[model samples]
Target: MNLEVLSQHMNLISLVVLAVVVAIGFIKKINIGFFSIGAAFILGLAGQMSAKDISKGFSSSMFVTLVGVTFFFGMASQNGTLDLFSKKIVALVGKRTYLIPILMFALSAFISAIGPGHIAAGILMTTFAVYLAFELDINPMATALYAKLGANAGCASTLSMTGILAKNLSEPLGYTGFGTHLFLTTLLSGFVFTLILYIYYKGYKVKGDNPLKLSDIPAFNRDQKITVAAIVIMVVACIGFKLDTGLFAFVAAAVLILLGCADEKKAIKSIPWGTLMLICGVGVLVNVIDKLGGITLVSDFLSSHMNQSTAAPIMAATSGILSWVSSTTGVVMPTLYPICDNIVKTFGSNVSYVELISAVTATSFAAAISPLSTGGAIIMSSYSAAKETTTDEMNKMFKTLFLLSVMNVVINVIMAALGVFNLGHLFY
Candidate 1:
């Protein structure tokens, strides 16, 4: 780890800078993307890569995807469609306030499973769930946590975002036919986490007078109806036809605006520009890390310490830790899928590859609620947008999320060790 050794090992150097970037960004309140981009440049140059080659790390596709989906959902939020729609759903349970959290959890899972993916579902639903927490006298922390958990849970279907990514990655590594089991692992493990959140928040004992009544509430107006239709079309396209979610969303949003159904200014403003920069910027550094073999180094480091009994849990733990600061879909899966091959080779063929893959996907997503990740960011940003929050409050929430995320990862780790995720026989 000396300077000369680090200079020759650009991957180690990049990882050192990545660790530093996270530290400085957290302590100084600076966007990590700024530091990530700078690190990319330095690392790329030191590796003899040109500036243009380094700039290629910028993920333009992800940028457009976020912008388009957010713009569409932003319009939905601004037009009161989100509020009214969520209220209508809440009204279904009447005064049984206890069902509120459960309903939101189920709804979040279903929405994410349908195909918009966790990012789109988590952003839109976590925002609405927070708003509902305020509207209905429920705990915002529990509400947002359920939303994030549910989104992550159902997003592992082969038809969905993370699930599709898992398939593509695993297929090449000869871990085919893992989609169904991976989905089941995430869904069941996610429910376990949701149950814990429910108990901790006393969801069953929740009592509140819901002011909304289905009988009294008016139906959607002409404009709202149009917005609803637009949304339905986007959902149908994404699910039924397997269209590009962001592109379809943009098209749907544009049609709604053309029909005079949404406020152009407010819809534009509702897009989370800062969050976009954070994800895409860190994404640049992630690209650099991938190209420089930093992710591979970390994966190798973890694999070097495994044995027959310890392999599954250790792999799960490693994926969880890496996912705290990285994208589970974009980075973790691609790096770890191949490592499963190595694990099997070293430890004999008795190791369940499906179990290992499940451990990776399940535990990595368990850490998604950390403040450094998108789902947790939505919770904080949505909270601030809903009310006047102090910097101290934000910091406190950040710490709280990290703790909750650790608890979640621990739950999955125990499950991994218990062989709960071992569904290999069903498929293989």
Candidate 2:
């Protein structure tokens, strides 16, 4: 075979390997990242890539960010700071059971907007949100959905990883001020989803006569107070001062540990290493795919099949589908953003670059509620660990979460097709 033919075959094989990695991870209950790394090794050899070339795919920055944020939050969890905050918030809502979901949503969104991003915020909020649902007789599925959506709402904040990635990706295409646009689009989508969940769950009907007084809620102890102060400092430094989020998070974690606010060993163990590995491994494979011409093959196919009018929704749907089972930042955006960029170039004035990017971003995040995604898995695990959850209830919640995930994908696609989040005018 000629060199060109061999190259083409390698590209096709890489694509197949990528799909198989996802499939085996889903079906065999294996860590998708582990398989992704294995696939990368095979594809690198097929493409005649050097070991160093393949290793370059691992994103040290992203890995550090994940570790620092998750470790800090984990220490907060260990020290009961998150619990204290949750209890106080619930007490403030006192008897207005309907407000529980709204409050949780707001809190989660605020935390995400400040800097931890959606995954960390979702993990923190889903735990307490589901617990509150059980205590308040609210639908755990609805609560979980609200928590995850709320996190996504603020995920596009300028300080968050999602926002940073979107901004960096958009600027090269001559689309400026995309970070704010992405944030607005994601926030609007999240609000719409939250409203749908609220209505579906009959939140308006919930009421209780008992309203807890402020005094009844426990005050923060010395350790909790220090933890809270550390978090506040992290937010101010990372957001207001534009400090490195990962570095700031690590500093805060260290302070907490040294101050005896959190146990050293447990806090160290609490970092979500598996999630980090999954993201980094997928990143390596995606880089390999790009190197092998797999991305070009896929982008060309999309361009051939889609015009300006259909491209936004098609790409949105594609992102939502893939992100449900893979890392949104690592797999979905890295792979699809280039395709969207190609579409914009192909259609020229016919396409709005900002709108296309926003749609893709929103769609990718909306699917984070799927059980396979980190946020959804956290919710499911939290619910299962709850003492109030019976086996039957757990099964029912699983079904509900699955259905909700599907609904979110459909809603995002429709929203993108209708240009509901067309915020290009806001930036331009």
Candidate 3:
């Protein structure tokens, strides 16, 4: 075999083996970060690389940053910030039961925009939705779906921590400053999705006679308070200091620990360490796939479709399909952001950054119905099963989510074309 051909074959073999390892790891429910790091080490050896080179991927700044931010979030949750929000949210929305979906979507959007993971937002909103459901005697599944859909929509719309995956995808295509564009489109799209969800759940009577008051919720310890305060300051610092967000998260987490508010033991105990590990592992697999030319195949396929006149509808429709299988923000933003920017620059259209970015972010609101999607699946599984509920009601609630998700996507596509509510300019 030719030397170049041999190298390509070796790389392909490594990719295949890496995929198998990841599959096995997922099956065993292993920590993804550790598994990925281990897989990288094994691949390096198989590919005749030094140990040092393989270890480099494990010590990535991104992973470290995520670890810190996650720790901080855990501490915040432990200290009662999430619980407090849930109590207040339930109380505020209880009187406006009809507007729960809209309220949930708005809150989910803001929270997802700030947090690094949509899963965190989903958990927070879902908890609150459950409380509201019990308080208002509404369907828990419907409320949960509302919260999950809202978080999914918001995740697609922002350039915040949760939207990092999308931002990473946009960078390679020369779409610098995509955050601004994504923020605007996401805001408009979120509003549209919220409206659709509200309409779908309309006329359903909820019946809670005596709900627990806010004081009934559990209290937090002092450590939790310090952690929450640190997180709030960290968020402000991300904007005020113009620091890399991951770095800010790490510093804030470290500060909280150093102040005796929380220690490494407490921090580790607070987070879903397993989930963090899994995401880290997924990140490694993604890196390896990119290195093995998988990204080229995907990128070429997308670049082939970059168009100005049809960008809105094409992206909206295509994202709806892919997002059911993956995160709309995760899959769509990387390719679409650049394509939109290139199309705008190429056409010499006067479409401002705001217009271009909002169109790109609107993709997520449309993808929330796919069972394969992270947020969608969580919503579906959480609310789909009830001990005493009829099968018919369960099916109806699910059908409602599917229809609402589609409507949200359609509305987002229209708004994207119309050039309204660019989040990128508002926050970024």
lDDT (Cα, 0-100) at 381 in candidate 1? 90
Q: Model 2 scores what on Cα lDDT? A: 0.78
Candidate 2 off by > 4 Å: 2-4, 164-177, 209-213, 349-354, 372-374, 387-396
Cα RMSD to the true fold for all candidates: 4.6, 2.9, 5.3
Task: Give me the runs in candidate 1 sitting further than 4 Å from their true place.
Answer: 1-7, 111-144, 151-184, 200-202, 322-361, 368-403, 419-428
Stronger candidate by lDDT (2 vs 3): 2
**Which pairs of residues have clashing backbones in candidate 1?**
none
Ranking, TM-score, top scorer first = 2, 1, 3
Summing lDDT over every window of 10 consecutive residues in candidate 1, give the lowest-scoring window: 164-173
* Model 3 lDDT, residue 278, Cα: 53
1-428 per-residue lDDT for model 2 (tens digits):
68768776887878888888887877787777777888898789879999899998877776777678778877877888876776777677766677877887888887788666787788878877777677666677778778878998888887676876665445544666566777889888888888998898887776644244567878998989998899889878976787877888889888988888988788778776776687678878978987888877887888898887788888889998888777787667766776677677778888877787788888888888877777778888987777566789767766777788789889989998887768547655
Distance (Å) between predicted and true CA of 156, model 1? 5.3
What shift in Å separates residue 71 of candidate 1 from its native position after superposition? Answer: 2.2
Cα lDDT tens digits for candidate 3, 269-369: 76656655555555554455445554454435544675554555555566565455443433344334544554455545543433554554566545665
